[model samples]
Target: MIYTLERTQFFTCGLDEAWAFFTNPNNLATITPDTLNFKVLDTFDTPEIYEGMIINYHVTPLLGIRLSWQTRITEVVPRASFIDNQEKGPYTLWQHTHEFFAEDGGVRVKDTVRYAMPFGVLGTLVHKLIVKNKLREIFDYRQQTLEKILNYPAHD
Candidate 1:
């Protein structure tokens, strides 16, 4: 079964500023929950995100069990939006789209994720028992962290 999750957040920042921070793959670790221990395998010196870009990372999503995930940037539109599809990951299918809009003197960032687990019926049961809540926790952490990161004086 395929599942979807969407979250939106507004920050008092310009479009360019929000675009730069969100597009940079390096910043992903900062917004992710510490318990997940998300780490990128490759170092990205440039903040420019482009189509065909591949990111490799490992994350401890549940029970301290580390899973390596690889995603490809399939679409990008500068400060507007980008879509990434999982090449290799825990999910049977994982596709996430990050979108940004300039609204009310701030940037409204939204994320839409469509994913599916493995193991057929067992996967559905597992998602009900674990994955759903875990995803919520992860996104909640991201929202709270971004609220802090995007509004502070240190934000650049």
Candidate 2:
């Protein structure tokens, strides 16, 4: 079954700072959970993210076994938003969009990810038993780490 996950966080930083930091591919590993063993397999010549940019990486998302994943930047809008789709990955489909907006006293950041697992029915079962929770764990870690890094004020 296809699934979607959306997360938003308000950062007490300027839009430019948020955009620059998020667009830098290297920062991904920093925000990702250590258990995943996420590592970029390709080097980026420049920090700037642009359309058609491809990123390759490997991660041990389960069973401590690593698998390579590749994603391409499908669209980019300067300091506003960008979308990336899986070129080769574990999922049958994956598309993630990152958006940034200038907001009162800071920047609001959002991520929308739509993805589907492989193996048809088995994939759906696995997603129900594992993938669903793993994705939440990963994103939860990211949100906490970003909050610390970006200094978002505490919410009531």
Candidate 3:
């Protein structure tokens, strides 16, 4: 079961600020949907994410089932884009590409994910029944959360 999802968001902030927000793993726990119960267990090297860096996390996307998630930064292009691939996680293959562009008043951000799950035929069933919607919801929450964070200053 191969699944791909792409989403774009416009933010009223500069490219550098946008890139800084996304590239910083610490902020991930904030934007991620609360339903996922996402938490970063071990931190990766800070400032810039380079290839071969591992991020360890624990999430409970489903009820009471804690999942150990791990992903590696497979590619990086400074403030332009980066790709992270799942090394050990829920998916059989999960690759997410984050691209940032300077728009008129801010930055245009795009997230593209290409993934597949385990269990072959059964994975397709799971995707249709649960994973697909879960992914959509997560990204939707992300957009809203980011908008609030980027629009308001720290003191706000």
Candidate 4:
């Protein structure tokens, strides 16, 4: 079964600034948790994001076991939103959508991730035992890091 996770954050920045910051692949490591050891393996030739862009990364998400993850930028809307689908990764399915909106005080950033595990019933068991909480922890760290870097107020 596929599982979903959604996170929303408000940044004290404009849509364009938020878009540029989020679209830059280099900034990923800055926001990601240190424990994950996430690294992007792409030399961005252009500053603007375009569809079909492929990003490769090495991440140690669990038990110090490093894995290669490849994702393709499937859709892009400047200053609005983008979607990335996993090409190869630990999960059986991974699709992440990032959206930006102009809110009262700043830009509202939203992320929606849909993923499924491998190994059928075993995957379900693992999800319950570990993956679910791990995902939450990852996003929680992201939110905290983003707030610090962006100088935005923290959420409860």
Candidate 5:
């Protein structure tokens, strides 16, 4: 039940700006929908998020039922790329890689996530029925939010 979700976004901002936005936890809240109630479980300073850093998140993927998520950052190359793996969550194993590259006078941000649901057969069924679509919705919202944020002036 391994699955990979690949997405790419081109931003008008340079590499430094793109890196800053992606690394800053505050930006996550802005992009995430209020419905998910996405919040940082780790202290801002404690999860200084370098390679091998572990971070936790709590969110309700469905109506009123909350899920606790744990992920470890396995790789980091400053502005170039980073990879995160889910240690505990709804997934059996989830590995996500975020890559940044200069492109078309701006920057290209690419995300590749390989994952498997929790239950042997039931989880796979749930993923195909609901979880997969929810994930896509979350990313779609994020993409639009990022486009708006990156297009605006930084000081604004």
Candidate 6:
């Protein structure tokens, strides 16, 4: 079964600034939870994100067992949206779309992730028991971290 998660965050910055901050690979670690030990391993040919870019990372999501993940940038619309698909990762299928819109002198960022686990029924069980909540927590951490880094007031 495929599971979907969506989150939206409003930043006190314009679309261009928010787009630049989010697309820069170096800023990922700052937004991600430190417990994940997320590290990007690739040296990009260009600092600017573009279609067909492949990003590699090592992350420890659970049980202190590190995993290597590779994702390809499938779509890019500057200051608008981007989509990333998992090329190699724990999930059998992982596709995440990030969108930006101008809102109240800032930008409203929306993230939608669609993913499926490897196992069949067991994966569904895991999703209910653990994966779902874990994903929410991760995104929650990201929202707080981003707000702090961007100097935006936190929301409830």
Indicate which candidate wins on lDDT.
Answer: 2
Tens-digit lDDT string for candidate 5 (85-113): 88888878889888999986689999898
Instruction: Please list the Cα RMSD from the true structure of every candidate, rounded to 1 decimal place.
Output: 2.6, 2.2, 2.7, 2.7, 2.9, 2.6
Model 1, span 79-139: residue lDDT tens: 8999999999999999999999999768899999999999999999999999999999999
lDDT of 2 by residue, 1-156 (tens): 779999999999899999999999989899999999999988889997889999999999999899999999999999999999999989999999999999998999999999999999999999999999999999999999998988756578
The RMSD (Cα, Å) of candidate 1 is 2.6
Q: Global CA lDDT of candidate 3, please?
A: 0.89
Kindly list the per-residue Cα lDDT of model 3 for residues 1-156, writing each as its tens digit: 678999999888899999998888888899998777899997555766788888899999987799999999988898899999999999999999999998887889999999998998888898999999999999999999999977645343
Q: Which model is ahead, 2 or 3, in terms of TM-score?
A: 2
Clashing residue pairs for model 4: none
TM-score of each: 0.95, 0.96, 0.93, 0.94, 0.90, 0.94
The TM-score obtained by model 2 is: 0.96
Q: In model 4, what is the error at residue 48, expressed in angstroms?
A: 3.4
Lowest lDDT block of 10, candidate 5: 40-49
> For residues 1-156, what per-residue lDDT tens digits would candidate 6 score against the true structure?
888999998888778888888898777788888899999998876767789989999999999999999999999998899999999999999999999999886989999999999889999898999889999999999988888765556477
Once superposed on the true structure, which residue ranges of model 1 sit more than 4 Å away at CA? 152-156
Predictions in order: lDDT:
0.92, 0.94, 0.89, 0.91, 0.83, 0.89
lDDT for predicted candidate 1 compared with the true structure: 0.92
Off by over 4 Å in 5: 46-48, 152-156
